[model samples]
Target chain A: MSERPAHGWQTVREEVLRRIAEKIWRPGDPIPNEADLAAELGCARATVNRALRSLSDDGLLDRRRKGGTRIARQPVGRATIEIPLIRTAIAERGARYGYRLIERQEAVAPGAVSAALGTAADAAFLHVVSLHLADEAPYALEDRWIVLGTVPEARDEGFEAISANEWLVRHLPFTRAESEFSAVPAAAARSGALDTAPGDALIVHRRRTWLGDKPITQVDMTFAPGHRIRTQQ
Target chain B: MSERPAHGWQTVREEVLRRIAEKIWRPGDPIPNEADLAAELGCARATVNRALRSLSDDGLLDRRRKGGTRIARQPVGRATIEIPLIRTAIAERGARYGYRLIERQEAVAPGAVSAALGTAADAAFLHVVSLHLADEAPYALEDRWIVLGTVPEARDEGFEAISANEWLVRHLPFTRAESEFSAVPAAAARSGALDTAPGDALIVHRRRTWLGDKPITQVDMTFAPGHRIRTQQ
Candidate 1:
């Protein structure tokens, strides 16, 4: 292989990753300091630093403030969990996507919902129930509560043409989000909606999003049995 | 609030992120180049670069080689998923953990396994079946295949004392890993092992690890109903 001095930071990053993959820099071994790496690679020290920092973010390197950087002895591979818009998720699976709005109304927030939203227990919010179908089969049932104070426009949009999921993504892009995945037994009402047997184990993907300090929305989505979510770098 | 020149890259990062969050630099707006930001902040361009790079990594900013940097119009919040060790995962949940080695044998690779491993269909591998218990209740069942050429020492370890999962983590320390999560119906064999009804939905966490180009191991772990995994950022 013809070799030339690597130029850009990304090129340096690839070189470093390849070295690590080849075991040239074994785990737990201290790599050269920034200055030395810069000298050897004939690049600016900042470029080398950027490459190292990116690798550290990927959990490939362990960098300390003073102790320098080292190959992580117990490197944990991080998988990025991208919160997918349900429509895109379904379409990616090569299935015809369908949506039906079951119910939409303004209701007093329950204790749990209010607590999760960090709002008054008696606060009223727009609550909506919708079903997502893949190939005309029930794929997921979504129960969502929208804080009107954070998303007042949601009250006017009748979710008949566009799903609240898509609406929020377009209007309010969240700065922070949390997701919880679990297997739960389907209750009677949910079973009838999802067309699954009562007590059948269903996958729940619960998510809450925030726009700065304001809670945007919280949704509990229960998927039909045999649903899958894949995460990768 | 007193204003002072930021001293370090991390402070610069915080300031930049706060700006983006507060809409001082609104989404889809082009940010100043690194040199100008460094001049404005009275720091080196490298420091500004570091801050901008970090924000980009967090999905707060979008950077293109030629297009420069801009606030992402539709920013997607990324959740870092740390691959968990089952023992540590259970212990973190405040549950007593137990393990049992159900079966271990050398078997010819099946079609799917061979395809995944990229090996001959008739190649023999060490297959293991084990069960994890939480508070004396069935928790998960693990079915694993270890490549003999990559991990020959696994043949000597009886797995009665230490699990293959922990053993591989300690010995192999794979450089790469892939994980997939899905809800699956428990088959007759898996149901008997997990003490669950056949056709009950189980959460499956399938993972494969590699050391460079060599396949190290592949495991399919099925969790009991009600199991949960949470990720936040």
Candidate 2:
């Protein structure tokens, strides 16, 4: 069995992960060197090295040039935040997704919005507000500002038929983005749109995206009370 | 310079990152193959391979057996969620951190909490409530349940001087954890402890951790209105 068939790097990665998960190798305990592990597992040394490097990237193991590799003593749960399309999110849950365009107009960028996008204070932008629903109930209220200077094509695509949220995600692929998660009391407008009483607590997701140095858009999504987001590695 | 001195893989990774950040290779554009990049950068092929593999894990590059490697068009910001100690978080922001124990008691685990921990309902747990303060202002309220079966040592840690939140982080090195983010209205008890009006919106972070198959602890942290969490890659 030592000279068994060749395997992919992913197979070696999963085996290493299983060993760590099973406590066969406890936290802070150094595992065998790459050459030794490769010999024992009947895999190439290069494959074993790749697997260990990947595990280290996930905060599962600590690797050093001279000290070798060991499991992390205190592993920070390294989760990937995949910003999904709103429609796709609802669809994955087997819920019927609904979208309605509330308002759209060309307006001067607000001070906060301008600061978020790193644009001039009073720069003109296309302001759009839309509501997303799951099963005909309010799920989230999106308020967005798209910089016309950065995305000129947005001017031609009037947002009356399609949401600026979906449109931007499809048309503009950003290189850099910043996002914040917070809670806020539902204001008058938010309450009306979300069908909730004013002053009710709501979770808010705010994001700003840029393509290289050009700021594309900034958006704030306010979810109805009891809305939750689960993330996993 | 074709035979440049040996360097660590991290050095090559950063150099590749700088080139991408500078837009020398635009998104959707393929850079040279591994052999070519190694030769041009005067590094070992294995070193270059490690750097490319790391970048691919980060969602910055797409690599395939036949496709070589190319910049990502729509990069999903891969962020590592480093669950920080609240005290450290407040101190990092240049604010004074304070902890107050609200209540402690032995009680049956709630149905939801029990299910989250994969334990049977009615299992006795050490329920602890506490408040975290930043510069004398209410910051977050924590509600936690420690599995007595898995963590009997917690019974001795009365949690008067040190918070259970901090204590668990120090004592427990969990191998598995799940977290959820949501918004909920501040109920009467939560409002009183958090110094917010009833029905006000609050951000809630819920987490359950396990050591191998044994459940360790589950915690819910509710932040005051306007509290924000920013995560980035």
**Candidate 2, clashing residue pairs?**
A201-B201
Worst 10 residues of 2 chain A by lDDT: A1-10
Candidate 1 segments whose C-alpha is farther than 4 A from its true place: A1-71, A186-188, A197-200, B1-71, B75-77, B186-188, B192-200
Q: Tens-digit lDDT track for model 2 on A115-227?
A: 87889987879988999889999988899999988776777887776778777754555656788888777763545789877656777888888765678888898888777
Individual DockQ of the candidates? 0.32, 0.31
Top of the candidates by TM-score: 2
Error of 2 at B70 (Å): 7.3
lDDT of 2: 0.78
Residue B199 displacement (Å), model 1: 8.3
* C-alpha DockQ for predicted model 1: 0.32
lDDT of 1 at B99: 93
Angstrom error at residue B187, model 2: 2.8
